[model samples]
Target: MAGTGGVSPSQTPTLPTQPGAMTPGRIGCAEIVRDLAWEHTPLGPRDRWDPAVTATVELVLTSPMPMAFCFGDRFVLIYNDAYADLIGTLHPAAMGRPAADSFGELWRSPGIGGVVEDVFRSGQPFLEPETQLTVVRAEGTRPEQAFFTRGHSLVRDSHGTIAGVLTVAAETTQVTRRLQNLSELTSRLAAALTVDDVARVVLGYAMASFDVDLCMFAVDDGNGFRAVRRIRGEMLDEADERLPPVWKRLSDDPHAPLVASARANRPSFVPDGEPLRAVASDRHERRIRALAVLPLRTASLKGSLSIGYRAAHTWLPAERALLNAAAQLVAQAAERARRFEAQHGTAQLLQRSMLPEHLPELERFRIAARYDVGVDGNAAGGDFYDAFRLADGRLAMVLGDVAGHDVRAAAVMGQVRAALRALALTEPDPPGVLAGLDRLVTSLGAESRNEEIFVTVVYGVLDPADGTITLASAGHPPPVLRRAGLGGEPPTAELVKVPPGAPLGLGGRWQTGLVRLEPGDSILMFSDGVVERRGRALNDGLDALVAVAAGASSGDPRNLCSLATTAVPGPTDDDVAVLAVERAVALSRSATMLVAAEPTGPSRVRQWMTTWLREWTVPEPVISSAILCTSELTTNALLHAGTPAQVHIDLNAVRLLVSVADTGTRGSVIRAHTDTMSSRGRGLGLIEELSDSWGTDPSVRGSTVWFELLLRSTSD
Candidate 1:
């Protein structure tokens, strides 16, 4: 019989009935049983250890947990079921093998053997909380998946001491991916705006939402849905329009079930199908093997939202609800932009009607004008210009810009322009005109009950006789002028700055200044839009306009006006209006002076008119038709030309020519007639037939026939 503490050197090998059981004659039985099993064994089959204990131990040896035993200094290990499975049926042969003998590779692992030895020597249960290890097979196969986990001690000896280690763990490969998917979905939802943006976000969310291979979003019109967003990994390629139908499919036939389902605002599911499977056969290129479409409806617009997966996928009710919520947010933003566009159309119509049609003709100046509205939809700006004849024979020209860009500003602009025109006609001078304009503005403010609005303007009255213009500026940019010269080219347009005054409705005394408009000088009045552009400073925009006007041709008023407006390339970002005035050129030397003439015979009138031209420095043959036209005019003066029978010629150094004028009271009129043989009325009619331009003023004593002919300077 073997003693509990140490088997007595038994002559005959007699096995004890129970190893750790208390028997009367057992040696060290109480101590051995107390330390090993921790309980005394009874004298029955229930208390006694079973004969199958060795086999059970052998079964436990093949478990996945590492199993080993240490008695004194020796280490004995039996590979567990998982380890034996790794070795594949060689486990029984590996029974009782030492750690060094069976797993020579594990023995060479840095510090592992030493850790086990320290556990054995120290008698303290050893634990390895975490470790990283590499396993190399003697057969030189490729490395297997590495593992990370912890191991603890198992004690099995008479004395309490560390005898073995056991460990249990789980792999983290799948869990890491779940966290990444969650992180990606959170990032995309933060900044989505448009339908396209939502679709892109949905593509990323759906792919990561269920951890699928790929995801796509498609939008549908009435018929069928087309893929608008397709994502695979991190790359997003813009959709190609030139691809074949199979490449980007949307069923053309309206009768298709998918199309009908989407049009009805119902979710349609497309699983493995007869045609769909064939169409989506390619795994990498195709977006998904399964699809779901939801119709999006908000107000008048209708579209579809689609979600798909490359793998055979099934979506939960929760997933469908999440997608539907995201779709609604996307639809709301799109509808807002649409409403903004519709309102902008109405505002533009009102803005266009408020602007003036034409500029009134000043006495000795040629005026050109243009007005351009902005293209920024629905929002109207307050920019206006008007030129019209005043009651006092002076031409009143007004240009202004309201402070804001809105329909209200446009309405205010119209009221201001109309009131200014009326007031300018009634007011005595520029200051009085502005003072009346201020009262109108204050009255408008009171009518609208709006306190946060104001306007800037430049008002002027041009007297072409002296070629002097009186003007006042109220918080407006100064006009520019390009003066003409006889021998030299036109000088750079000078900026005609005025002292800033309070804007309209802000009570302040306004001062007026007079500008001398020499014969060929050009005057430009414009709103701030021409000199304040986006990405450019006010000074830079002004400088650029000056340069443009320097090179621009002062031709027809309409063309010059167009050039000035186009000179500042927009999007001006604001409304623009410009008015230009230049002196008209003279026709001939005699037309530059006011003279007297009387009719006697055809030769005498011609010679008198000819000698008058000579005195005015006119060459002989140069006045050929002019001479005949003068004879006709003199005959008409004696016959029909009314009181103050004098010819007035206006020298327009701007166009380098003259305009002829006369004052005729009554009974003198020029009518268009094709008959050439008429005698008694031929004189006045003949003047009209030969001149470049001719007109009559019945309100004055006589009328004037103005013709434009080339004036050759002596230097030329």
Candidate 2:
């Protein structure tokens, strides 16, 4: 007989019995037990078995919980239907076998066989709150981790001796895995900064965690709800894939699951396809059999998240709780993003409104400017660029930066810009204009009683008649000059050596440096942001700018401005402002003709071009090609622009440039393949094939399409 030490008395089983009550059921594990040849095993025939063993077997077979009873010293197994399911494929055959034979190495593992042996020998009752086991759930699959809480109780025979041990188990694998996934989700959501980033994280987690076929994230966009949907299978067509993710809009329809869930501020689940099919308006939605919609309710944002399955499923309580928790995280992130975007938009709008809306359009020179905020665009920086005509008809351009990133800095910039323009109206020289700004900044600092007001500016004035530009600096970076090559020499770029004065507000002397620009020459002025990288030296950034500007193929002011802004490789911590002015080629002779909007426009332009070229003693080959290119441009302007076109021709010693300008809203010219049969789209192709160089310049009102033909070599 086994002693009852090292066991809890409460966990002992009550083995009640009735005489001759060993009737086996017709179905389930009971029938399998009655049919097994027990005479081959240690327990012998069923009729010969002890009454206690029979009673325990009956209890194990009838109980709903997963229970198995080990009888005698060999620990032969007798389990119910639920226990058979717990062991997966080791059923029927494992019914009457020893526990070691059925569980194999698992039975010999620590705490499993030892606990059963202890309970059987000592009559002790043991309980394990949670135990992890590697189990092969199917016949030919690898083992996977399973968690369970199991209890073992001793069973006694009719002679009042412990005969076997009975065990019960409850699996907790699903709950354990879900909690771990939730923890990981929380960590990932913490790093999400933007609304789109949050959506991507949430959608990926839901799809992987729930093993769903489809997931969608929808946000309320004032007018309606915009949704970003992802599917696991090839349910969407190629055309749908090309469209943006926010293409679908869910209105305030009560029938829509997302809208209804958001309106009621709760989650909605449908286990069967019939209910979903009745309200399904999209073909994609009709294919789903199960769906769960979780509403995201936040102070500033209203949205909903949904998961779908192609097979019917029951929405378990644990799954629902996890989904709701994920939605809460998403809502919080979205609210934060919404607030940040709102502030960023307001700051950008304020800064842009204070800057000049348009640059003065000069006839002999072209001007272009660009401004970019820092990578972290949460605040408005004090970087500004302006180009205006002075009272003496000289173009005045300034690029400056104040030392702050706030509304106050922007306000001060606006003041400095306005004061510079007012002073330039009277004092057109670059040095005088900067001197007046220095005093204004000093006065501004004194009025505010703050000595932190710092400003750096590089002001310039361009005289179009002599192509001379005068530049002055107030502790700002020197301007770059891209001098066009003459007589077969390549263009060269260098930083202007202007005397650096103390920054404004400190009161220092300012001096000017003058440079004469030739035809196709350009001067670029920029704030320090353009030449200041986060970790690199300022000289290195300056050298990189010179290289990029010199290597640029086009001398167009807009192109140069764009190249200067992107001269640095990495992100910049400050705002950038670049202003570029290019001196047009000196024309020996120029002619302009405003062609009518009639069908005879191309013919008339061709006749005008040929007559002018002939009178100028131009070669017949040049005249023929120019006439053909001009006719193509004129026809395109009329066909596409649907407006009158101005044909302008400029003749220099080296090249002849002809341009067709229109007042229409067509802002770009697209080149197409030259098809002889096509009448309308082959104009640009002819220009490209016939001219030595061709380009287009898009402006505020219209576009200029021009082509240049080299009449003589640079040696001429």
Candidate 3:
């Protein structure tokens, strides 16, 4: 309401005329006092209105607060500009209306009218420190419940009797809702597990709970900072390119809010929100006006969480304390989750290491080896297979099964395998290797005092120069021979009969059996578990195995192993190991090139490899990879071993197998993880990255580093 410089003498309220005749100073009060219906009130009319009633109405209308005056039996009402804002859609229509009609629902709710009535009857004031009331608001699309502290005073009329109640109130809705939301957030974050799970839960809840425009959590996983963000309850890509400013600021500023919080181990409140606005989206940069970062700390980890506000938000002491405490809990949960994952992974790695790393292959034969654990546990048992070329360039393969299936069995398996390898390098024949291994197992039993730690194995020696296999069995299953197709005869398989000699650790000397395999002939060596079923007889299981192999594609060892798995459709108690190799009757043209183990060895090897691949018309991609593998392996042998090296290249119908024999016994294929590795160590890593499959077999002379790549069958 606009006011004159001062009320003129002529315009002063001096007459006892009609209500409109006297101009009230306030707009809402003037409109109410001048209404024609006011003459019907207990006070009669504006001309007869009590001087005290007029004074209270003037106090309400002129005051800058959410105040309303109620007087007489009807409790007539009047409010100021501040109260009009609170009334929202119930404004002008509610003016000059009764208190009951002015605040219809609020009056009826919690019997607020009763408080006013009681204050009207008594001369004392009625006060409620803070209470909840649902009322319509401009900010809300519907009615919103809020907390308000209200006070009501009794006002008398012209006769000095009790008139009505005068109300003064303040809303505390935002503060009250915040406490409730924090409690809910604390409850939900309790069950979060992984970092991703924590981010999904916390970001979704924090944005809505704190009523912020954005929420982000950055975790330090010992490597680097990784952040997860949610904007108004919607997740954004953690690595979103548009958020470079935020990432850069966090990285560059040592004293930044989040950085400071982490360093000081406390929360940093940025009331101005300049830091947030500077990095926020263009639309929200102007909208968000405050930011805060809380340090997340646990026994093993420390991190930071940030929040941005779209409206002016002052961080309360209670709010800060709540977030800090909750973040500590979140940090503990995240730390435990990571620890559990690391421990579980370590256990799995230990179990997997007991199995073969990679199967060895040669041009005269392709090798396939597979070891499957028992149905009861993921831990590998004592079943093991190995195919390694001897120092003399002849291949020696072994399929062994140690009795029992526990940790002790696995330990003995390793010992027996080491003894067999050592014996193969010295003993010239398969029978000699078996006899030597038996004596070694007896000595191992004497040392361990575990007589039950016996082992059964089928040992064979293959001469690549000629097609011959010297085989011996020590109570192990006999080898299944898939005969070569010759002179229009279809291929057939027969179990190679050999004496089932006493198992190792029992002082038995096994005899050898020699087989001159024709071209296209193959041998399948496996542990007894492969053909031993729960209910079927051993002979029946063997027949089933042959049938499965017949139906399977004999293209590679992997295929044979996969077909072997189909033989036991149901669960089996024991672990299984299957090794398949195709015999070469008529050999292909092969080349052996020796490169001096010097600084130029790798370069010379690569040049020769390129020439050989071009002569064979190899694919360009394969040729490039071959050249790279050859250089890496050759360079590693020269730089690390300081011994002469040899490269044997064999290309046939189905595979391209390259063997780089080095005098270095320690050089093997590198694992994917390359931490704390030297130059040669990383070179081994490069071979792993470039080759399809590669391995190293330590011989008495040195080690043979080899890799194999599959080629289409028609390439044969």
Candidate 4:
């Protein structure tokens, strides 16, 4: 047989080993062994090699990732220090036992022990890319968790023949968790655009990634801390819709423990026992037991993300590292959400501010205007109306609706409204003004790229001398007409309907019409939401509006608008703008006044109003109402109408017109809350309750607001 001790080349059974192979002094092999065997000495310099090899065996046996060797049908496990920490108590007397005796649960796993046995028998190195296992130790209370195990076999020889196997593996729990969290984070980030959505994503990520029962994020709003996002069931039963129990304020609370500690770049982890005690009081103990708070700071602002568990659970350094990384990512996402919200909110506010602040006073008309945004949550729509006195002393009125609901539409609406205001001053006639607006829109490159933004507009120039309204339309609905003489009888009004011409930017000619206005005659102009609706005929909406306007009460514009709005008895999905212009009816022969020099005092003013009403034959039940109305109006004018403001009355035959003149320029807020227990603000609103027709007039010097009440006689 050709030298049995060392076979010939053709009959070789194993590869030849180089000199000094398996020796203790080899570079790569000896270095690995030394690391597996020794620990750095804390007191002084220590030798790298362990002479007896016992310390080396122990170090390998207690490693975090599993390491093992095989000797002919026997398996030996050599783990790092973490393995000892897990099973040291149970195996105190069995430190160096075989895998079959010490950890049967791990040794019996499929392909693990059998593969090591085969490697020892065949003298072959074996490797596995990935393996899964459930390690059930004898000491732990719960079942073992799932872990991915990867290992490779090391072939060893004794006396020129293969005799043993060596292996190593690492648990993959952290890796799996990271992948799941990343998937969830991507999904949430893609869908989240609002502040609330962002908060929910951060809190949800913590709950899922850290395996916590309660997770929440709080924002610092300068004044106090409030919970903006929270995981499901994270809060106590009583805190369903309420804010955090204790909202710590930085101004008054110098020792604001949570914020201060977070600012210091330190986290506080509590296993149990009043985890949030520094921020909340004893009342929060029932809900919060154990918590870890990590401060989230991005772009100079600081907030906190908190994770809580029902019971205290100890955490390892690796777990803390994972949480820190996640918090940083959350901070970045929150910053992005904030930027998106800022842009969106600014657009909305700008659109609202661009609307007419206050209606102008037409010489003989009582004008009331109302604007309502859509219920749908989309970008701003191009619905606008304006009533103002032109520089040449004529009344100019315009109402229009843009073509779409988006940023582009809102910006176009804004530009058009501004441009129309400027052009109306130079163009006297209605058609002339609209034509000028059309030319400007085409010339300013607003309609570039063949992209069109058509506008349906109705502009009018009212001659205050004769109450004649000269109107123009660019594919807009005809105006509605109502008169005081036709009240309660369904006013016989007609739509000054014109031919269907193209809207603005359609390269068509503009059309104009004229209608004479009488004292007590009203004209109503509105967007499509008022006269056109889905699933309903356009004529039906028009007829219904006509009937409601005929039945509306003359004294209050707010109530009249409300009545017309509710006429359809259905939902409106578009923005609505209703501008009503009516001539206030002059009073018949029934009014008188009693003037008092000392009208400044509240009691005296009350008495004077009461005596004057009594002399004018006012009803007994209505006297208290008149006094209350006058008192509120007088008081509000004194407090908010600016200095040097004065009150005056123009009493005629059939009506008493009370005028309050002041220099205040800001518009008044009007509310129609009907509850008796509510506190109604200001005197101007009270005038609406007592007067027949009321409105405000603003001038460069000041403003004059007037209200009227029907009188019984002029002889009192």
Best by lDDT: 2
* lDDT digits (tens) for residues 232-294 of candidate 2: 753333222221233266767788888778777889899977445655667777789899999
Query: Model 4 over residues 440-522: C-alpha lDDT tens digits?
Result: 66664454654466788888888877888888888888777766564445345556665455678766787677887777667
Clashes found in each candidate (C-alpha, N, C closer than 3 A): 21, 0, 1, 16
Q: RMSD in angstroms, all models?
A: 31.1, 20.1, 23.6, 20.4
lDDT of each: 0.52, 0.74, 0.64, 0.55
lDDT of 2 at 668: 45
Compared with the true structure, the alpha-carbon lDDT of candidate 4 equals: 0.55
Off by over 4 Å in 4: 1-218, 222-341, 375-378, 444-447, 486-499, 531-535, 555-573, 587-716
What is the clash count of model 4?
Answer: 16
Can you give the TM-score per candidate against the true fold? 0.39, 0.58, 0.43, 0.47
Worst window of 10 by summed lDDT in candidate 4: 237-246
Q: What lDDT is reached at residue 375 by model 1? A: 48
Model 2 TM-score is 0.58
Off by over 4 Å in 2: 1-213, 232-247, 274-281, 314-318, 586-716
Model 2 C-alpha RMSD to native: 20.1
The worst-scoring run of ten residues by lDDT in candidate 1 lies at: 238-247
